[model samples]
Target: MGLFALLNRLFHHGPAWLTFLVMGLAAAGLALCSFNLLFLFQANYHLLFTYGAMAAFDGGLLQFIELTAWGYLAIACYVVAEGCLEGLLTRIRRAQL
Candidate 1:
């Protein structure tokens, strides 16, 4: 099975504390991702306001690319966190029925 399926199965059969721990970790991940995203935006504020002029400076292209990659990483983290939380919630709902 895929990673999500495996995780779902594990959470489904695991103790209640295990699910809660995973949920808490996921929530913390989401919060950290949000902060990283915000930091990326704030750090690039000058480049944004300059209308791409700052990108003409030395090493600016490399910095921009690095920032883009970091932004993607943060987004991926957010997606993973959301997925984990969703999976846990789905398991909980199914168990309640």
Candidate 2:
């Protein structure tokens, strides 16, 4: 469906394409960042390669030890919070319907 339709479904329906999409993207972001940080760690500290498995989420020269795993937790929280928010929105919309 189109973007507008998709958004509508997200704000309207409880769980469907939109919810699944959120979950999928969230998972991807988690996996991507996890390995990206791993790459940064190895590259800077140990001078190793991560087989480019982190290209998607790699922050390039923005690597640091502070936000390594925290980023993953943040993404996961966002996904769950978003899913719940969308679910609440759906309930509200359905009630109005």
Quick one: best lDDT, which candidate?
1
> Model 1 over residues 1-45: C-alpha lDDT tens digits?
597676665456666567667666766765664566666655666
lDDT per residue as tens, model 2, 1-97: 6965655666456465556667667666666656566555666443224433364246533454455555757566466547646676667777898
Tell me the lDDT of model 2 at 90: 65
lDDT of 1: 0.64
Q: By TM-score, who's the top model here?
A: 1
Where does the lowest 10-residue lDDT sum fall in candidate 1?
Answer: 53-62
Count clashes in each candidate, considering only residues at least 3 apart in sequence or on different chains.
0, 0
